[model samples]
Target: MTPIGFVHSTRTDATDDAWDAEATTIHLDGDTFSPEALQGLDAFSHAVIVYWFDRVPPEKITTGARHPRGNESWPKVGIFAQRGKNRPNRIGVTTVRIVDVQNLSVTVEGLDAIDRTPVLDIKPYMLEFAPRGTVSQPQWSKELMSDYWRTIQSQ
Candidate 1:
């Protein structure tokens, strides 16, 4: 499918994880997109950005994994189960705050995508539609989920 738009962030690689911690500005590529595209977007405090991990090294996927969450103590989980950069589609979804919007640039809080990431879609945040009641997560996901989410943001 054709990409409808793209995301622009300061950090260009996964190694530069500081962008989330420092609140770097993120811009959208659709400079001429209609304002209607952002309808009701400001009502929520946050949004979910779906994007492609374009720069991930292909060898990472071919070479297999290096342990889940970089923890060798944990069993070897497939790349798909964890947030491995070598995902089949190399797509990433991040929830970030809508700091401001001007023209087509959306200034957001904590999107973990690298610079020039291909944005697949943008969805508004709604607690009712969130994962609060979802139980489909794996046992390891449930156990290793962060207790301090809002404090430290990442993919």
Candidate 2:
């Protein structure tokens, strides 16, 4: 599938953590879409972004179970059980704060994507889309994600 837009950010390398400090702008292809596409997006507080993992190499893709971050303390889990980028589909989805939405560009805070990442789609986040029932997970998963969404505060 083709990309609807591309990310613009100072972040060039993909790190394991500290994504909440990254602020990026998603510039929709003006030639393919018009300003009306994002007209009502500003009304939303957040957006769910679907992007392609263009940087992950083919050999890195795995289907078997492995420890998260290669930490032996964490139990081995299947690819689908975790949010690693080594999955088969190589697709990434993230919910980010909508900082500003212009005609064809959307500035978002805390997007876990790098510059030039191919954005497949963007949808405004709604409260109704959240989980309805209780959410359960192992202690290891919680520890693994303890700092995944922490923002870097200025000194």
Highest lDDT among the candidates is held by which one?
2
**Which whole-number lDDT from 0 to 100 does residue 14 have in model 1?**
74
List per-candidate RMSD values in Å.
4.1, 1.3
Candidate 1 stretches with Cα past 4 Å from truth are 16-19, 22-26, 29-32, 62-66, 132-155
lDDT of 2 by residue, 64-123 (tens): 999999999999999999988878989999999999988899999888888999999999
Candidate 2 regions off by >4 Å? none
In model 1, the Cα lDDT at residue 116 comes to: 70
Query: Model 1, residue 74: displacement in angstroms?
Result: 2.8
Model 1 lDDT per residue over 47-140, tens place: 8888878787776553355566676667777775677667877878878888886655677877777667777788887778776664686666
- Candidate 2's displacement at residue 21, Å, is 1.0
Tally clashes: model 1: 0
